[model samples]
Target: MNDLLQHYEIAKKNANKYMRKGQLNAYVDALIEMNHYKKLMKAVIAN
Candidate 1:
């Protein structure tokens, strides 16, 4: 969770240097995926 967030933040910061919107969007999607998985896991564990 933390790692993914950090990676996303770093990627966003450096995304302009690459001038690739798709690449930056990929990272954003990945960050959302990580959040989703984390929540899913938490629910499963609680059950």
Candidate 2:
């Protein structure tokens, strides 16, 4: 759980940095991918 949160934090920071650099598309894509991964993890954990 702690490791997953750490990875999410890192990914959030990277996405924000990309957005600040005007890489909106990349940032959005990264965010979407992150959310998808989180959802999948939740589903797996619920099993």
Candidate 3:
């Protein structure tokens, strides 16, 4: 969880850079997908 959060923070910081260059949408989408995976991990851990 901590590692995932760290990655999220890092990705967020660079997200804007990508957005300005018009290459960030795909990266942003990837981040969202990663978040979903993290949620799934949390759910699995909870069980």
Candidate 4:
């Protein structure tokens, strides 16, 4: 729970950082990771 939220925030920040740096690939990857955490969070809550 907390860990997932933390990782989600980290991934979001990393996505923003990569976007600002013009690293398209990295930003996309970070976004995917963020979404992954988001889904996991939702699943946890649902359970």
Candidate 5:
């Protein structure tokens, strides 16, 4: 899961770079996905 989070972070960073090229939606999606991942990680750890 840590690895997944790292991958998501990298993807988010890449998406950020393209925000000027019409990737704002992608960036927002990445942010949402990252937040989902955080929630998932919390749930897993609680179990």
Candidate 6:
């Protein structure tokens, strides 16, 4: 769970960085990855 949160934070930062750099594709990928991490975190919390 801790690892998942770390990855989520990293992905969020990467998304912001990519957006600032105008890298649309990379930003979208990072957003998708962030969403995946969020889902996993939710599942962990639910259980």
lDDT of 1 by residue, 1-47 (tens): 56645655665455553445556666566566556656765666688
Residue range with the least summed lDDT across 10 consecutive positions in model 5: 11-20
Model 4 residue 38 CA deviation in Å: 0.3
Badly placed stretches (over 4 Å) of model 3 are 1-22
- How high is each candidate's TM-score? 0.51, 0.65, 0.53, 0.98, 0.60, 0.98
Task: Give the Å shift of residue 31 in candidate 1.
Answer: 0.5
| Residue 33 lDDT, candidate 5, scale 0-100 | 78
Per residue, candidate 4 scores C-alpha lDDT tens digits across 3-43 of 99999999999999999999999999999999999999999
Of candidate 6, the 10-residue stretch with the lowest lDDT total is 7-16
Clashes of 5: 0
lDDT of 2 by residue, 13-41 (tens): 88989999999998998798679768766
Query: Which of the two, 2 or 3, has more TM-score?
Result: 2
- Ranking of models by lDDT: 6, 4, 2, 5, 3, 1
State the local distance difference test value for candidate 4.
Answer: 0.99
- C-alpha positional error of residue 47 in candidate 1 after TM-score superposition, expressed in Å: 0.8
Cα error, candidate 4, residue 8 (Å): 0.2
lDDT of 3 by residue, 1-47 (tens): 67667665666656656677788676677568567757866876798
Give me the runs in candidate 2 sitting further than 4 Å from their true place.
Answer: 44-47
Local accuracy by lDDT, each model: 0.58, 0.79, 0.69, 0.99, 0.75, 1.00
The best candidate by lDDT is: 6
lDDT of 5: 0.75
If both were scored by TM-score, which would come out higher, candidate 1 or candidate 2? 2
Output the TM-score of candidate 1.
0.51
